[model samples]
Target chain A: MTTTASAPGRPAPVKPGRPLRIRRRMTPRRAGSIALKTLVIGFLLAITVLPLIWLLLGSLKTQTEWLNSPSWALPENFLNFENYQVAWVDGDIGRYILNSALATFPSLALIVVLGVAAGFALEVLVWKGRGGVLLLFLAGIMVPGQMILLPLFSAYFQTHLTGTIWPLILTYTATGLPLTVFMMATYFRAVPREIFEAAAIDGASIYRSFLSIAFPMVRNAVFTVALVQFFFIWNDLLIALTFTSVGDFQTIQVGLLNFTGQFGQVQYGPTFAAICINVVGILVLYLFLNQRVMRGLTAGSVKG
Target chain B: MNNVFGNKRAVLVFVGPALLIYTVIMLVPVLWSLGYTLFTGSVITGFEFSGFDNFAKLFSDPKVGEALLFTLKYAVILTVGQVLVGYALSLLYVFWLRKASSLVRTLVFFPIVLPTVAVSLLFQKMFEVAPQNGIVNEFINFFGLPSVDWFGSPDTAFLVLVIMDIWRSMGFYAVLLYAGLLDIPEEVMESARLDGAGGWTLIRRIVIPMSLPVLLSSIIFSINGTLKVFDSVLALTNGGPGSSTTPLTLLMFRTAFSYGDYGYGSTIALLLTVICLLVTVFIFRSSRRDLTKG
Candidate 1:
């Protein structure tokens, strides 16, 4: 095993069954190692994050500058706020944002409310045939949304729910439900029996115990489910693309695709600006809820 | 306490909303699509009970064959690329990246949140032609290689889709596998290390085996997800340069929506669903076999 005292840029070799504990004293070799790791990971991070940064910078460039200059070249005017204005006005991005929010928030709220309720029931309440019902929802996890797209579209058309935000909302809620319920169930089930039993002795109803005790016990799961559902609905293009016919009802993703499909080459500035804002909005949200999102995504693999 | 906790009405109240929504929105649609396949019609012409006619047509459709082959190829490419890159990055995280891994993981996973259209647009900008050649092409030209039209050909367009899909998703796999790796008890790792296990030997014998379930889960996940891929490819290429990159989902969407061939599209959708289900079951069975044997 290589020791940090001897080898620069090598991670401290562990013995076994122990977390990688950071060394306190920095020898010259350790310092160099730290610097090198920093540089390498910094480079990797740069590769990952810089494209979006470049896209933001590119958004600021005039159409000619964007087409003419090296992608890295600083824009002629740093304060090209007009490009964002154009993206908002000409590209119809604000409406797309509004549509995305309309589609996403309702779905997110429904996913949480329903997910928490179902999770509590399956985990806390003694219900008959819970396993069978759970296996049913588990099967939903295997379903590809494409399989349902046509029939759902037909059903929506039959019911006259097409071309509106409601179809989008309903589908998002439905598709998001299985995983939300699954993830929430896992989290709620992990809460100790003693906690619930204590609440029950106070004569709390299952619903009341869930709200007062189990919900707080699984706040992280709530965050995880909400954040994951947010990304799913926020980034969904297929539902909006296929189900919604009204242009005004299209989500930001569909709107961007349509914008890029038509004006991508000729109107480069506003397109990049639109992409920039879309990326920035999601990136900001991700940053704020980073841990919960990661937990949600990785929740499946970690849980049985 | 037991009385309050397990009251039948309370149970109903707790689980009713999600079960209802899930049934109507999710589960019903699966059965509905299966039902739709039995009838044939256009949105305009109205449906008639056609009785496996759509499936009959699907059997003879060369386009169906092409789309299936393309989807299989696409799924294989994405699943391999995503998992391999993810595994490599996971190794990097545990072995070398260490503290810097957090930021790298964060940076990598950031793409998972972006709108698929946004990612496709950015990458499209990166690969588009001159006078505003994408920076990638520009970099290639910087090395003085002749300009290559990436999306101009079937092969390159497919390659571009694969690469773009990998970029958008590889981070997700890395984080996923990394979490799995961290779950391996350090004693197993250290003992493996102490017993002269290093490099490939350590990862192969210890890390990978310990992480097999997660590995299997990810493979199943990426493959099925890739099989059903639509939004990214739709945004990136729209199955174009002449349907070269069209997956089943895109084909299904176009057939049903664009051509208004509701029956045929439903048929393709059913095929894709079956493919996903088959792949999932096969992987689960194989992983179980591995568990028992290895």
Candidate 2:
């Protein structure tokens, strides 16, 4: 999985007979260089990691402590799950998480299935006017969500789907498709056409060949596309905000926004805790899928 | 093979659902949005064709002008920060850290996946001034300086917004440009080094030109993404401090949804679309011209 993820634009293999450069002896210049590198790396690490740690610590603190204590102070008790309980129950973060999942997962499934099919037809299958069709899809990528927001809302309002998760699912899937199809087409184009031809000669149906041959060949692309779209759908605020009303099918982001407005001033601990809940959910997923996520994101941008 | 693969029915099966959904949900709404610019009022009030009145109103609206200026300023600053910082980090990853940069890259990239609301809350607390001093104020107090209200004024709020966004996104750009850097053959660096090209000279003459395509891609990607800067600003500032920080998207949302003025909102949306298209074309044309010149 890792190998395939990094396959696109992977560094070239070193040439044979290339002389390996010897490391220079420890000198003042080298020492200064190392020192400068250490300073820069350390600064980057500190800026990136410290706020998160501070947030974690803040979440563990009691409300009184959060209000009175210095921001950098450690929590008096690390075992205080009181804020977590308040956040999960009172803040209704769990419901928002479920709502986000409800919107995100179905969107991912649609994007992948539809995207792969469209990509395969556009790139792999012998077809006429695929170029024009592909360009149409690609052009959708440039259309800002703002351009479609008012119309979508108006349409959803008329259809009486304004407060449901349907709008989010449909819009996410549709907007996500342009990139998904483009990336999948890029991936599917790399697969040899002869294999699909061979399968057809062996009496395989188009669906059969796509399912058995093309899909497996581009499994990495599927994962890449899925992960990329997962981040997008999961972290989206605009479509989610526009489609769903407050407290009814509101995704985690909108919920968090309302949560902050409600509790941000008076209840610092639970508010931070609520924010932590959102961050921790994404962090857990990212930890598990970081490599794939990184590779997938880079592959799309670098190659596309 | 030709008969089976080239079947029109199979092609429709493959492409029908996606195209249908894309057209209905995406493409149609865009055209519809353009059409709405000719009408006034929301669905509840019933849209009446006013025929270019929205355009006339859009040109004269002072708030629209403010939002446009803010949007352009925000996009330009954020794009530069995102791409430049990302390029610098990528350079650091390739040249300085090299084989040992993966962990740093991963750590830095963590924030990119974080939800915007969560990051905004964290930044709010970090820079909070009213209820109690946050960490930033704590540090200032430690230095015997007065606590700064980071979000109190428009300038400071915008500053915080810029910092938060750059911090959140630079890592992704780093990894992006890093991928491009990897594709630069090691032999090129080796040969360049052998010719006494070191430090900025090697980067200026070799690395920059070699990685120009990805850099250009990053610039375009960053600019377009920034120009559509709805979520981050929405979450961070909510275009507060008297709408000084409001981008066109948020204003459009407010106009259409909050104020029930769909026609003017769509006009604003059209303006944004035109700006994005113009910027993209400008970048592409200039880059192509540069490529030819070189």
iRMS (Å) per candidate = 1.9, 1.1
A155: Cα error in model 2, Å: 1.6
lDDT of 1 at A129: 84
CAPRI tier of model 2: medium
The TM-score obtained for chain B by all candidates, in the order given, is 0.96, 0.98
lDDT of 1: 0.83
Best by DockQ: 2
Encode model 1's per-residue lDDT on A1-304: one tens digit a residue. Answer: 5565576776768887465767579789889988988787887787787778779888888977876677668899989888899989988899989998998998899889988888888877876888887888888887888778877877777787777788898999999888888888888777888888887777776667777888888887798778877877888888888776653598888888878656645677888899988988877777787877877877754442
Error of 1 at B64 (Å): 0.8
Clash pairs, model 1 backbone: A9-A33, A17-B186, A17-B187, B130-B133
Badly placed stretches (over 4 Å) of model 2 are: A1-25, A302-304
What is candidate 1's DockQ? Answer: 0.70
